[model samples]
Target: MTAPFIPVNTPLLDGNEADYLAECIRTGWISSEGPFIERFEQAMAATAGRRHGIAVTNGSVALDIAVHALGLDEGSEVIIPTFTIISCAAALVRAGLVPVGVDCDAATWNMTAEGVEAAITPRTRAIMLVHIYGLPVDLDPILALARKHDLKVIEDAAEMHGQTYRGAPCGGFGDVSTFSFYPNKHVTTGEGGMILTDDDALADRLQGYRNLCFQPQQRFVHEELGWNARMTNLQAALGVAQVERLPRTVEIKRRIGRLYDEHLAGLNRIRRPVARTGYADNIYWVYGVVLNDEVPFDAKEAMRRLGEKGIGTRPFFWCMHEQPVLRRMGLMRDESHPNAEYIARRGFYLPSGLALTDDEIARSAAALKEILA
Candidate 1:
């Protein structure tokens, strides 16, 4: 007889999701114009301490909207941590803006304020601050530099939905901030994202950009081209229920992180996620494990062994500087990010999903320990 397989992520959606979807179906309000869309936007905005939320089809498009809303000059440079997903760079690249790469701290795995400061130049117009894994980038010095250098701040709080920085909400920090509701996130709407902001004029632009830039004054007139990146009433229906249960979900994530910490302790050759910092503890969006140099095998070989044990694993994000596409485009031609490279090659996340069971954790840990040992 074989044991059950453990997946990397299984979203916990035991909330009012069904009830809200039923409401949308019963009332025939299933389009983006439905009542649930507005309700979800308002709920997310209020939670993030922002005056407005513009829901989008997905998080990638949300960053697209955030970047374009700022209207940064073409050929302008925006600083970004090289450790983030390709979406962060894609947003800048699509807008004809340059993405200046900076390395993150080896410990927290978040970009350093010092790295970002060094990367700033006369062409610098904005900083795309991404909160990685579960810990946030140190914002005080970075925000201060943004103020002093007059650079726009676009916060990527996709994995930090219920997280805080020095008592302030993650989404509340940037001039324009964004969130993702992918199934893996603390809040899930199946597939969705939100752009949050306090500026009234910027809020209007965000909404317009999300909906093909339709002019209310003349419904068919278009001054500028924009994306049809509208989130469905169905996704928002789930979002309404999911957003309300954020606090409970956050605790669940923290609990999952704690369990992994206990299980993987004493594995000297492996580095665990930082449990806490002065400003915040890891929300443990996913439990990342970094193998030290002494480990006999790389992540690929370890994952192969884990797979044989019916354990699902995922490798960490490949550093942006090392991305072949960027290299071919004449970017990062003469640069190196050792810390980002070190983790990307050697790290992978265990099964840290919301629906993961205690027995599964024990089983997964045993399997990995056997491989590493």
Candidate 2:
């Protein structure tokens, strides 16, 4: 019999997930309103070291809420990493804000403060920073620049849950931060996300935006148009269960990362994820592998071969500046981010999900080496 295929990402749901779901069904509180929603929001706020957490349907929507809540001018520019998900840029664009893409560092695969500094303009309103894969963007210098320029920092900590930078929480730094509880994330809410903030007024606005801007003074009245991106009680129930087991989950991810490091140490054809940086250790959100020039093929070919061996893989995010949509819209028309462009073509991640086993990890690494050889 053929062996099973190890998926690129799978969540570990061995917690109170079933119990929470049972409670939700028994109580008939499965909509956006329920005790679990508040509980999950509060728990996540505490986890992220923020005063308030606004639950939403997904991370992309959370970004949309965050960007609009800032109340930036229509054409204000926000700097973001070029090598990041389209959702990041889309949030700004849809909010009538301009997104300026910056190149990330080759080693950490995270944006540097210097690149952000150079991208700052008089019309720059905020630094919408994202923590890439597992490692965090160097935040201190960026925070300093934000302070100097009196700009807001919108932290996209979707990939940095249970992570910190220089002993501070990843989601706690910026004026506002967002987290995604996708099945692939450390905290899986079965399609949920949150916006975190210490500012009471901002939190209020965020809540309003996520829920159709309902006015508290009157029922079924809306002074402003907003998204109906509220998270269901069922999703929040899962989030509450997952947040309770986060520390254990983080440790599991770290162990998997270390094992991959040991097993693939001598594979010169592929570059491993950065183990640690000056301020923090990589949480290995995904054990990304970059094919060097000697590999003789791009990530697509490598992933195809790995798939044939029943080892799943995923490619890195494409550079936003090179996106056809952005160029077609006449935004960043002729820009290039060299480092991100190079990795976007060659980098891909292995099976690093919480459901992965030791044997699977070893087999995946062995398959990769065999293909390279």
- Give the TM-score of each candidate: 0.99, 0.99
CA lDDT of 304 in candidate 2? 97
Per-model lDDT: 0.92, 0.93
Clashing pairs in 2: none
**Which portions of model 1 miss their true places by more than 4 Å?**
none
* Tens-place lDDT digits, model 1, residues 1-373: 8998999999887899999999989999899999889999999888888999999999999999999999999999999999999999999999999888899899899999899999999999999999999999899999999999999999999999889898888998878999988889988888999999999999999999999999999978999999999999999999999888889988988988888878888788899999999999889999999999999889988999999999999999999888899888877667799999999999999998889988998898888899988
Candidate 2 residue runs with Cα over 4 Å from true position? none
Clashes of 1: 0
Error of 2 at 31 (Å): 0.9
Candidate 1 whole-model C-alpha lDDT, 0 to 1: 0.92
Query: What are the per-model C-alpha RMSD values against the true structure?
Result: 0.8, 0.8
